[model samples]
Target: MFQNQHTFHIPVMGTGHSIDTPIRVAHLGIHSVISVVDDLLCEKIRKHYCSEFDLAYKNIPRSAVDGRAERIKAYLETVHEIVTRKFQEIKELPLFEGNEKDRYFNLLPGSNPLKSAYQFIEHLSDREMRERLIEDLNNKMRPGSIDVNIMAKVDALGTDKDDQPLSSEYSDASAALRGYANSSLSSSLVLSAGFNPRLYSYISDFKDFYRDTSGEIKKKVILKVSDFRSALIQGKFLAKKGIEVAEFRIESGLNCGGHAFASDGSLLPVLLEEFREKRDQLRETFLPMVQSFYEAQGWEYPEVSDEQQSPRITVQGGIGTNGEMERLLTEYGMDATGWGSPFLLVPEATCVDDFTSQLLANAAEKDLYLSGVSPLGVPFNNIRGSGSAIHTEELIKKGKPGSKCPKGFLVSNTEFTENPICTASAEYQILKINSIDESADTEEEKERQKNKVMEKTCLCTNLGTGSLIRLGIMKPTYGRQAICPGPNIAWFNREYSLDEMVNHIYGRGESLVPEERPHMFAKELVMYVDYISELSLLTDPGDAEWKKLVRMQKNLEKGMDLCMEIAESEAYEGENLESLRLTVEKQRMRLADIFQNNLVL
Candidate 1:
């Protein structure tokens, strides 16, 4: 367990605090995802319903192979038209009042304050404005399908010029207006098949825009693979190809409903085992094929990213309890875990937060509640996680008016003295049964209690932080879908339901929650735990190092608190939500600060 003190690049682009930034946060080393969209309809469905809705029932049957392509394309055209109309209505919002306009306005990147009315009205041509208007409309629309030929052409780059890549004014306009837009979208084809062709477009656009975006803001792209089989296949191909990608994520444990592959009775453990068993074979199979392709170019050795082999597996979706998680890690030797729905629902569960105890209590009283949607949903009610389907269904059921952000359930936050069935009793028992001191207790009982307490705390602390060693927070919503603040807050409201449950324990205001805190904190602590655990394996066991580390951590917390307080106080006079969150994060990562300061110890 030697500590590999290697310097890895942290992607700071597209992962900012605001929705205006790219919709990716955190990366599990080089093994990350490169998300591509089939179309942009996902955005519109989200805005109108506060969830995603598929209108395939209205489109022709998928079994109809003859005109499938045309039908799908027509569906996309309809989506574009619908989204355009919706946006046009938004333009007539001056007559309405309340927060609706703000939501729609915030949905797009360059809508507010007109980006200088003089520049907007003066320089922008009528055609550019029309395209901009359409871009705004298209922002809400999701793609019905993506062209695979386009991906081949784009991924090939200089490798193939005979296969010309198609460009669209829509994508160009989107890029121009939003600073960046995706090349493809998550459409029916990508949902049904693996590897949307638009991924190539995204890669190319990102590469091209990186030059321009670097000067503006770093953007992030969260790649979603609905099917693991497809993801693995596409991943192998990408690795074999010469592409400088950041990570490869294996998203699992989601209830994808009836639409996606993983959810269509595709056993999780079986799929995982199959991939684990065949990964090397797949790699081997692809390596020679790529080599032969390169050999044809008279290149003795063409270097692919696969040659260097920088692929980190990111475990996302739904991983059950700590025991289940431990088993997955020990079984697969997983590189990292992306706590998708679980992290979204119970962010602090990764760290065994106070709310975690409450969730355990609720689970004991009631059957475990999991999200209905795969990738996004979980089966844990107190955790407040949901899958894409559930969310979309909820939106569809609730209708457009119901699409607004849902409010956190109002629960008292003060400490509990009574033996509440859900939490108080559990905490008391946990503290009592796990006590460290044995004085005045029956000898046998005292000894057991002391051991239990120590073991439980240690395990909880370890499990809490250990989970974060490799984690990434992926915003399920992106682009025009995120333009409106309504859906943004709404998405978080659903995503961070567990936080709401935890806030009840703290008794603070509802609006004070940090959007990224629970997830980010879990990630940072996990890194700290892994680092320490690895070090302990290599070095002799002693309290000197551990105690020193703890002491250093306490000191770092003080400094972080001071810095956070100053920053918070300066920004919005400490009243703003973002400003206050900085304070909480300081306390969360205080452990890392200590370990870094006393590295030699």
Candidate 2:
């Protein structure tokens, strides 16, 4: 039950990149999340870690009863053991320069008690006193939480060998939750993507989620939210079930790395402002309901102060610099921050393959785009020339557009088949394309419709191929490797060591990114303006979509005004305010022209 000593946690990247991140960074007291979307991939990586650590490995076949859950459970337990073993070794090392033992403390924030103690005793002359302090520091030192992420809405219902659908309990998210619940690791479970009432209710079945007699929660719940409303609603739902959310990790809607959940034009700074004002509402509103549930269940609730308790508000997505981290922590009152996409450039931290890593390091801002490649139909943050994209385009040129559908984890389409099939699958694409061709539509429109159908790539397999390649579990040409990096990856142009990346986050030595790089807040404004402009082009005025666009326009204006105030306020040393002021004014004029044109409509 160790806590994260660092100020930032590494958010879960695509299905593959950060899958084994905890093993790479957790022992250094750095928090990182693993995605359990693909149990087959998890099973393979479990074997790799076991072989590397010289631990026992028993294969969990996909056909076994509750095998998906069982594989995830086994993998998580293995990670827990390895991280614990690694942390103990780090603690045993003497505090010497350039050693991991020193790195562990040096990685922590300047204000941390453990780090302060280590800094105090590292140069002490008295051998006995120094030895006593070192032992005390070891006792107090904690490894970061080995947290796991479950894309809540990606809970595809499973089918047996005969193609009979299984019960709700055997669904993807439920089984993943069961795996984490059964694992020995005591950490938070980040339920992201969106809400699944079934998944949230399924959480009540695990006693580890509830507080014990000692008032300590073994397994914590972290609802990955986009805004305050989602956080409030989801938090209430869990609270009524006697489950208090440990954190509401707000991610940017369109500015994030994975499936972009573009809200009705609401921006990140605006969302952070909402959480800042109503963070207490999260505690006050949920507490009474949580206490009532505990009372009804005949369980004793902890008498914790409202000032200090569960439901810490944290924000992530597109954070690039230490000044930005400081603003999030100090200005917005965020408990901690999550740094995700940048870590993909750090080989000592992520599981990116060599070929893919080169592409990411050399990628430019124009190369990173919001693409229509997700089988889920959400706008995915994609790179321009990924192996998967190239492979898909080649298939189209050969007059065969669609994937072979290897894993079938994201099979949610029912456009043609009675049983749901993935849009990325050959069967669905073939049926869809044939129907479009036969329709009485114009040739240009038909081509557009057909192109949309072929945009779906089999992410279930492609996303995990990078990890398999890096671990030597699969060859480079096994599958077309797909990578999803945020636009921030454009600023970071090379692979960084673990110590170097941590130093960048803390603003210790020279900055890793170029000095001309825009502040995280300013960069978000540019992204939002660009995103809203795209929305205006796609929607006609006075329609349902256009009404949403109108709301977005107002929100953007308010958000921009807030950004202006931030630029005008007391500046943090490296905040880069000039870029923000210039960007805001430029985007403001662009917004005016868009509004004027819409008025003509």
Q: Once superposed on the true structure, which residue ranges of model 1 sit more than 4 Å away at CA?
A: 1-169, 172-194, 201-228, 236-241, 244-248, 256-262, 288-307, 342-601
Winning model by lDDT: 2
Per-residue C-alpha lDDT of model 2 across residues 1-601, encoded as one tens digit per residue: 5666788999999889999998998889988999999999999999999999999999998789999999999999999999999999988887766788888888888878888888889779999999898888888988889899999999889888898999999999999999999998899999999999999999999999988887788999999897899999999999999898998998888777989888766778888888898888888899889889999999889766664355888888888888888998999899899999999999989999998999999999999999999999899999988888888998999999998888888989887888889999999999999999999999999999999999899899899999999999999886588988888899999999988988888888888888788877677777777877887888888889888878888988898898888889887756787788888899889988887887797
TM-score of each: 0.31, 0.98
Tens-place lDDT digits, model 1, residues 1-601: 0111111111110111111101111100011111122112222222332223343334343233222223324433433344434445555554124443333322222322432332343345687675565456433322111111111211211111353433432232222212223322221111122354454434433432221212211222223443446655665554344232223444432221111222322233444555566655545554565455445645454333452333333344333223323334445555444332223233322222233223332322122222222111112112232222233334334532112211111111123333111111234334444443535778786865543322211111112121121122222231111000101111232334433432322222453333333222222223333334444444443467566445434533443454344334332211233523553475456545435545555
The Cα error of candidate 1 at residue 255, in Å, is 3.8
Worst window of 10 by summed lDDT in candidate 1: 479-488
RMSD, each candidate, Å? 20.6, 1.4
Q: Where is model 2 more than 4 Å wrong at Cα?
A: 305-308
